[model samples]
Target: MRKGFLLAVALVAFLFPSGAGAAEKVWSNSVPDSVWSDGANWVPAGVPASVDHVVIGRSKTIVGITNAAFAGGLLLSPDVSLDIRAGHNLTLGSGDAAVNIELEGNAEIRTVGASALAFDAVNRLNLNVPSSARLKLGKMSAPAAVHQSGGIVQLTGTVTAAAGGTDWHVNGGLLYVKKNDAFSGNMTVKVAAGKEVQFEKGADAGASFDFSAGSSITSLDVADATSAVPALKLKALTGDVILKLINVPATLAPGDVLRVIDCDSPIPAAAQVRLDPASAAKYEIQLSGDRRSVMIGTRAVASADVVVFTPPTDTLASREYEPGVPFAASFDVTSSAGQALTVTTIPGSSLPVWLGYVVTPKGGASSDVTVTLSGTPDATVSGDIPLGFRASTATASADMTYTIVKKGSGGAPGPNPNPRPGQPGPLPRPNPGDPLLPDPNRKSRSGGGGCDAGLAGIVALLALLPLRSRRRK
Candidate 1:
């Protein structure tokens, strides 16, 4: 029985062979041409099928994909290169399993024309472009998790999002988006120390990173390097760009300048550049004369103190005042740096003709001062009247608004002269006898005197008269 079992196992092994399962195919370059479809160019003497793992190891030769191809995974060894030729496609992975494409040691993969690389699996496409690798592709579609550490990836076409996941971690690399191509995923650019990532226009005059597709970067860290050129250069901006300064030297003295961004075209009015609040506190940030570059003056000292104005709690015109009555309200004003402040009403925000304000001191030059708003609102001014006050020093100023709401006659709130569209107007005071309105003098039917009461009276009268007619019938 043991000999029979051994003979059967041997027969099965001989028929099936170990090579029947998935195998790895290495690029041998045995043929004179570099076509990937040529079986003679790969080891094992056959083209790689969907169940094969392909590798290009330590070859300077550029392997070309002239036709549609499939592979379970692909790896490029140091200095090896590959290209998907024009109009060709390369599909990676099979079934519902995850696959990987690793480019390391300066390996490169460039796609020409409309050629594309796609991943065909439910699981993620793990792409690692590290160690100075370069990947320039027209487009890539997959549920991808891309990690780049010290490499460059220039994407000229869109990277469509998938259900599995699509994210990018650019730890120390440049991920350039060309020609308004959109990346439909979140990208975090946390460049390593001593490194910088730049966003610059491509060959197209209108090229820009298209963040309008709901894609956004967490933040950009700008080092205080003295590069004459701006770290971020573009012709125009389409979305908000947030920046935080990093590696600021402790020895940086006040007034030292740092250049950050440059725009060849005028920045869109809707676009904004948000700077870190902490960085803004320590630097005087402004754009150049032509609005081409952004400069930061380190630790700029304020020339003069700023005045702080504190309005009353009822600053929003919530409280109603009686017309033609003496109204008085007071607010305090102080200086931020304890310097003397001057208080005055803003030029165009003068109080209404019947209202006036008086500062505590005649000259209005004091560190801590009070402004009193005292006036009898004119009977004709039976609505909200806004008053403005400004506290200022030599270099800085602050303004506050005080609104006075005057009630109309009979203690009713005054009507808005210019009510906005869709705003409900005052309720109509219906006449006492209006048919559409309920009569205040009328009694409820349940309490009698309505239709119910009249019906009951008729029924009572019929009962008292006895049902003689009905009985006769």
Candidate 2:
């Protein structure tokens, strides 16, 4: 029985043959010009069908080694792609390796050592990244260059030319053309030092050019601004940008309030003084320069706006005597240092004893105008407003309150009219018949009750005298 078992085992071993360990399995009927013993295939000339991954020689195979040099090229059809792993080195001509690897649907080529890799018209080329496998070009004599027209190309590692020369050369690297001959979206071209980039006149119309932020170009020669159909709504002129005024109302005029809020950062101050060239009012009142500091004499000083009242047309004719109700004058508070200034107003007084104004920048940002009134008075009295204040926009009514005064043995009351006195102050007088006399609610203490009490008391004393006489009779 033992002899029979031994004979059967020998027969089985012979039939199977250990030669399977030495043989290589070929798939998809794909054959290589030369294959290594350790199952590596080499296509020096080129491959007929596209390949996914090609392994190079291992420890065993000295397969694809060739002493006679020749030009090798690999052309992958549009539907196929190529992937070359690490440790693969393909040597070309006795002079330099002239290997061309072309992949169709977005190919990747990576090389570990001093080698060169080239691409042709691939959608995207990822070089030296493991995730996106690429063809390796081991140490050679020429520089590695890539040219692409359509998709994105990223360089994971430093790339040098195989052919060492300062002169211009286009190694068989990336040469891509747009699949549809149309302009790409948001195209930005960046060129670095020791790098040369060129652009041919685009087939379509001219496009907008932006000299990146904080970046300066030595010279930009545009054919013509009018001819180039630039899509940019604004263009920078002499480092300052000029924008087209959009949605400007026809009614906007010089001295009229035009407030723009919530604008882009670093917005330039708007020219306050704008003239209408075509109108009869050709020369506009220029309130430009600085709002914060006005040059007084030779010195720069912060001053508040002083406007003399322009008498109302309706009251100018009817109102009585003297320089007739002077226009209330007030000021917008501003400081010498382009900062918003604030002034406190007397309670109940429209005229701000202390006022605030946006310090117009010497060359900074724009400021807004806000009005606040304070102080106690018999009536609400407003002061002269600055140039930016349009009366139509003011909350004050057409009528104004003037301080009222009575002789009362005193020639004038309370320092007589301030601002400009002897204009016969318009202080309110107490009437004997008025039931609301000596209004306690009045803001001014003078008008509140003192005057009304004095007049009412005198009349009561006379009435009491008659009553006392009748009682005595």
Candidate 3:
């Protein structure tokens, strides 16, 4: 029985030797020319007839692999642009074999295989596929650097993704989302050293994106539902940094630390933090205070300083010079500081007589005149100024004194030149010609003694009578 089995195996090997050898040579020399023109699709230039099964040679472009998949596996060479349009699906067969399409220049590929589409040097690779295509990257010998400059990984169909289990790097490039389409899935989306990935409009807002110092993402605006109206989410990966907040609102969650060094005055009143649900693992909400020591989870931090602004109080009060007062207007001033206060007037307008004084005006007159307070007197400022008027008409001479009194106390500023509830008029000015105006003293008449005719004639007759009496005697 052993001899019979050995004979059968020998016969089988003899019959299938050529068939078995054909499959092995399929990958050998699979590389094409430097450039593959549209001759007939993957059918290399010169394939020997005696070889029977053609092998993929080095530095060759494998054009149409539709039939090549049925025949055997296809091998792609490096520094070669593999241009595959839509509806071209290339598959990798069993035994853990690998196929690679090198995109040296501009190239489009619809890949569905265990193998990967590698960009050896700086190159643009466009992967256009139908419904979400999944390709797994086993391991990277070196870093898989994809330089997609002016090349687009377009998804003409519905939701699609390109996920990498291993490290997949994108050096200086863009992940452009075409209009009316969406790209989703968990992707590291690494930005290589000194490279960036800018996400423009129509790009997914919630893309699990991070950035390097030399790299950045652009046109990334937040959803309208968030408290941060049209804000940005910067995935912090480095040490202490100050993220500038422009026209965007900022909200802090519990366990989130933020530092504000120097800020301009008059901070917006609407500045506050709101809890974010998407990142709930951190905390609910965190609000900063004024210079107070607080904690955002384990982060020991302090709040920003609050500034209070005050306006000028000079317009409400004023002062002027009076004759009797020293060099200052006799005005009253008090202090709520519970200490003696000093009032100073505008420089150059300082009084020459009194250094400082409080003058209270009272009367039924226009109250629009500017009233000022000046003085160093340290009591509850309340007092009056005496108004004395002397009349010197063509006939009479008389002096009138009127008390200019203040009704309220405690320096309650009020009616000057006008009479208060208890005070008289702001000492009335003496009238000369008006007879209806009464004189405070009854002894002094209105006119002077110059027009006393009767008294003068009586004096002359009395003088003559005295003379006649003297002669007769």
Q: Give the top-scoring candidate (TM-score).
A: 1
Q: Which 10-residue window in model 3 sums to the lowest lDDT?
A: 307-316
Sequence-dependent TM-score of model 2: 0.26
Model 3, global lDDT: 0.31
Superposed model 1: Cα runs more than 4 Å off = 1-20, 30-33, 147-150, 163-165, 171-174, 184-198, 202-473
Model 1 CA RMSD to the hidden true structure, in angstroms? 24.0
Reference-based lDDT, each prediction: 0.60, 0.28, 0.31
- Where is model 2 poorest over a 10-residue stretch in terms of lDDT? 292-301
Question: Candidate 1 or 3, higher TM-score?
Answer: 1
TM-scores of the candidates in the order shown: 0.41, 0.26, 0.29
| Clashes per model (N, Cα, C within 3 A) | 0, 39, 41
Q: What is the per-residue lDDT of model 1 for residues 287-401, given as tens digits with 9 covering 90 to 100? A: 7776667666675456657566655453323345677678777777777676767888779986777767777742444467878877776556675666667787767777765
Q: Give residue 268's lDDT in candidate 2 (0 to 100).
A: 35
Alpha carbon lDDT of residue 315, candidate 1?
31
**lDDT (Cα, tens digit) per residue for candidate 3, span 1-473:** 64753454344335324333332222223445322222233333332222122223334354433322222222222333333323333232222222222232332333333223222221222222212222222211211223333233443232223333222244434444332323233333454444433333233322233334432433322222233222322222221111222211244554434331112122223323222343333333233354211112222333232111111131112222233432222222222222222222333343323233343322334211122434343233335433332222222222322222223321222233212368664445345444577433222322553333246778888889988988999
